[model samples]
Target: MMLSTDNHAPLRRTPLYGLHVSLGGKMVPFAGYDMPVQYPAGVLKEHLHTRASAGLFDVSHMGQIALRPKSGRVEDAARALERLVPQDILAIAPGRQRYAQFTNADGGILDDLMVANFGDHLFLVVNAARKDADEAHLRAHLSGDCVIDSLADRALIALQGPKAESALAKLCAAAPSMTFMDAGPHEVAGLPCFVSRSGYTGEDGFEISVPAGDAERLAKTLLENPDVMPIGLGARDSLRLEAGLCLYGHDIDTTTTPVEAALEWSVQKSRRTGGMRPGGFPGAEKILAHFDHGASRRRVGLRAEGRAPVREGALLFADATVGEPIGKVTSGGFGPSLNAPVAMGYVPTSQSALGTKLFAEVRSQRLPLQVAAMPFVKNTYKR
Candidate 1:
């Protein structure tokens, strides 16, 4: 994941900085924050541990905002937000959340986000690198109807794995009862927190947003659980990649639309053409047109035929022997769970079908790969 573009700025530290250092975390710059790339267990172990048991991640760097409607109705806030993203925000019930993207007027993505209906208000979590822009966008557009409160005094953490429920339930008794995408205020470890039963790792997990002052204590308490290990950005990236989740700057960006990124499922039918309230959002014209017709290129999974892992920015080709560049690998790395190299990239729609053969140029050598189904691993989200 490309954390930040400007490297000269001073790196900020999260509330868990001390905890990470104490745990022997290897610190690195990420999204203008001094974050841990991995702990003493290493990236491979952290990745496997998260898959086998549970892993705790410090994601406080991401931005969190609360949108309160002036009219004291969440539906009003949802309707106002509809002018920004294409998702069916009005359909989000209290204590539930949905995935969405902020698109530019040109029909390109600005940033992908998670929006949760918290009864009286809507909670939004945006990418760390794009938080400032997103906040400004919201303020510039919805200031008249909504009160945007940026929750900078809170810390965010994600606990993910098959054992996540049991581990979190030990501290937050109500954790087990919430199903996937459920989001609301809850008392966790006797501390007030905003809990969401969702994650980027494709595992059953909860993202807890707690007061910054109590974050360290909550992290330590969760770490006391035998199944939970401190994971860093390295494992977090691989986990999400293997799960087929898009990294904001890598897989999807200003140049890519939701349809081209294979995220059409997130654009609900309610917002598409012929829906009750349609074509009101930014880029709705071009985006919805892509829905009606089709995008020239599509994001597809690439399975390398050999053990060599193809990194990002590698140029793709149609034939192994001779051909011009056909596509490019946006996110590529070794999938620890699959024990093989997997990648996601954009290819011509004609070459995007499953089982279609393709080649990626790695170190001047063309390596064979094939278009494959995504989620390299099956998602274990709790329904």
Candidate 2:
């Protein structure tokens, strides 16, 4: 949700900027691009619509890269990629995607990313903010035989919610065949597209990557569906938060390890010490130790007692009077789907259980909080 443009630089615009403006989208500078924060229907309605029906999001700012081996072997490229991250990349089948994180030497996360086995090459979708650093890391460590191709000519868009699959299948007949985390190339609306049955809103959806020149046409074609509406950054953040998804710089960073962020599931069993392929990526020792001995602090879900929504950086305490601070809220907000305030943050391992009682200091008042299970709402993925 960190979308502020640099003060000195000029703001950029996506290919669908004109369409957004024509739809009465309120443009705001975010991550160097002038993006829509909300449409005429506002953030709350957009958020609800995504859960009830479908929503279209212009995510062209995300970075897309492809790793191809000069020798034309998929295993060669997958093995080369395993050197940078602690994920079982070599085991991923063609047309399947895996969630992974780039770790540092000190067992901290550089960024969380999605890696897809696109048959002949590995496709990656990295964060818009950390794309430069991630690309630099890949180029610096990967073998010379592997080539890195940045797809600057592409534009990415996500169509999310319950009706997403049916709406999209009308245009691309093969889209509905893909299950969760499956990705493949198809012609959508008569345009070449790489469609992934995945999204951050905990819904059944697809993230479609199309040519930059054809982005507007693809978006307009999708919007013609009554189930689909344009959603903006404000709703994007709220939806992901309600789904308990981490917002890169805020929830997980270079200082936070995958174990501490409660993302150990992303580190596949094969990547661990006793599996088929083990201990090859950065910080494997320290990261693996957390699996043997639990981390000192762990991320957990928090549900506030009342309706007063707590925001990020709110101090957390064990007692209402606050003898000492225990943790801080990383992402917190009102979940339109749940009709309640939900938050996620790191707390001492002792207090990270499913129903531990806690307190959050918000605006100089202590609010009672209970450590609860995440995904404040249920995930409706097609898997």
Candidate 3:
């Protein structure tokens, strides 16, 4: 299991170690990796650069898991995958991808992941913090008909922001042909790689999976471009927050159903409503019910005009009535794109409507807040 916790804060190094140190990257322990928290340029500059230009993130520490044909047939393996997630796995076209979560017996998300079909195999990228547990969970439940392979030596990098395409085009112009949710094999920084036109940030970007040995070379080559800067975890959180994207273990967890997480779009209508394929995966009965009855505490956006930013675990109340704590702030931060403090969390359906007035307790003050629409900033998904 990639999640071995032998060293709680053990520092694992990626191939880009030397380059990061050379560039004055302030390294820290994150998900078992000696990661670059920020560079000499500073976190604010890095965040602004990514919003205006492009930023490259070395995320090789995340899990790269493969579910091979258990019954020796890719279709059969895909069918088995349906038992784990609510997505129409078999319907995925070659080079296409889908986002889903591993559900526990009670129908709560274990870990959110992106599953990509490469015609010949299924590739996945999971959170680094939950990599070990996620891999074990997948392996334990996988039908004996398939086998799981771990790409332990793989390095993943994300080139994100507005100018990502142009920066990447220097290496593989063919990447432009792929639409959102599409992935294709391509080379960048003179190394073999896989490029996906999908990211947690709402801006256009690509997630590249490369061999561990070549990650450093690729990172250096991309950084050589004046347009590319090294972004840190701080910016990553702010970017995803502005995108209204959920961060597993924070915005979602085993207790939060996908429906409540407002990720129903990931569950294809055809799969849920029953067309060519039927829903028989675990907790389908309960999950489908949410589709019909609607989730009670829904994940929604909150925009507080005040300068004070609400942090996680803050209790939320509806209007002046402080009833049962309606919900709590999951992920909150300052959005560079919005130029204001933004927050997102779960709130009762009664108080989830747009413009619904709510109060967030921050620093002993009842901060007046309102539920705002998600994507705190508009998305620029390049079709």
Candidate 4:
């Protein structure tokens, strides 16, 4: 879920807007775009359908950018980008993508993004709400070394589920061979597109970036498959929540650091204190300190003891009668796959151990919850 911050700005429409409307999608404003919240199948069935088969998502509102190095070398672009994110962009091999975050000088998260090495230039897919700020950040820092090209004419769609590979393979012969995180240009449905064997859903899938003009045709062709269905933002949120994936602005934001967010995995050893090129990125001091020592708070998975879904912003406490909120839920909902209420939140490291019991205040009642392992539903990524 994308949130609309500015109510005055006219909502932008994606290339597949017509298709979504024709398919009976419930339109809503999200991140300044008119996006589908759900279809006639409703969020529950759509979420289950994706887990059982394939689900197509219109993620065209996301920003796609190309970082072309002035030296005509991909390494230069990678190195330039490394200055912004904590991830080791220099080691990313061609046709592979890696998740990363942009950190602030105060060690807070600016935004999280995916960086793909395209051999010649670096490709970036950033959150819709932060795209403008992200582009401005790049221009402010790396303008002299790289050329930033915003791919506004492109539309991004995700085909995700157990049957994603088979469905995509019918159109793109190379789909089956692409492993997790593999990203590159390919002929998808007779249209030149950038295809990545990765998605927000924990299921095996592909995120295809196509030209605006051909997006609707490609989507229609994909939906022609018996196993594929058009998914909306509602199911997308619940699906990702069940998969233990983070949603920008909610689960993560400028107030949260990558270390506190339990995203230290994205920070490679090469960027750590002892490595060859360490501590150059923004907030290296504070972030690395958290790595060397530890963060006071940690993001953990929560399983509500009862049926009540502990939604975001619910205060967490040590007991049913609480003195103060120790933390707050960042993302939470009923997991359709798990058939239970699941949530994620930050808490004191002391209270973040697995199986540690806690309580969440909801509607004047402090309900019981436990610190459980993530991915309430098992992930099916083709790793």
lDDT of 2 by residue, 67-164 (tens): 99988998999998888899999989999999989999988899899999999999999988888889888889885869999888899999999999
lDDT for model 3:
0.83
Task: State the displacement of the C-alpha of residue 202, model 3, in Å, after optimal TM-score superposition.
Answer: 1.1
Task: Select the stronger candidate by lDDT from 1 and 3.
Answer: 1
The RMSD of every model to the true structure, in order and in angstroms, is: 0.7, 0.9, 2.6, 0.8
Q: TM-scores of all models?
A: 0.99, 0.98, 0.94, 0.99
* Candidate ordering by lDDT (highest first): 1, 4, 2, 3
Q: Candidate 1: which pairs clash? A: none
lDDT by residue (tens digit), candidate 4, 1-383: 56687889999999999999999999999999999999999999999999999999999999999999999999999999999988899999999999999999988889899999999999999999999999999999999999999999999999999999999999999999999999999999889999999999899999999999999999999999999999999999999998889999999888888889989889999999898788889899999999999999999999999999999999999988948999999999889888889999999988999999999999999999999987888889888
Model 3 stretches astray by more than 4 angstroms: 1-9, 70-72, 320-324
TM-score of 4: 0.99
Q: Candidate 2 — what's its lDDT?
A: 0.92
Error of 3 at 64 (Å): 0.6
lDDT of 1 by residue, 1-383 (tens): 77655778999999999999999999998999999999999999999999999999999999999999999999999999999999999999999999999999988999999999999999999999989999999999999999999999999999999999999998898898899999999999999999999999988899999999999999999999999999999999999989999999889999999999999999999899988888799899999999999999999999999999999999999998897998999999999999999899999998999999999999999999999998999999999
- The number of the candidate with the highest lDDT is 1
**Per-structure clash totals for the candidates:** 0, 0, 4, 0
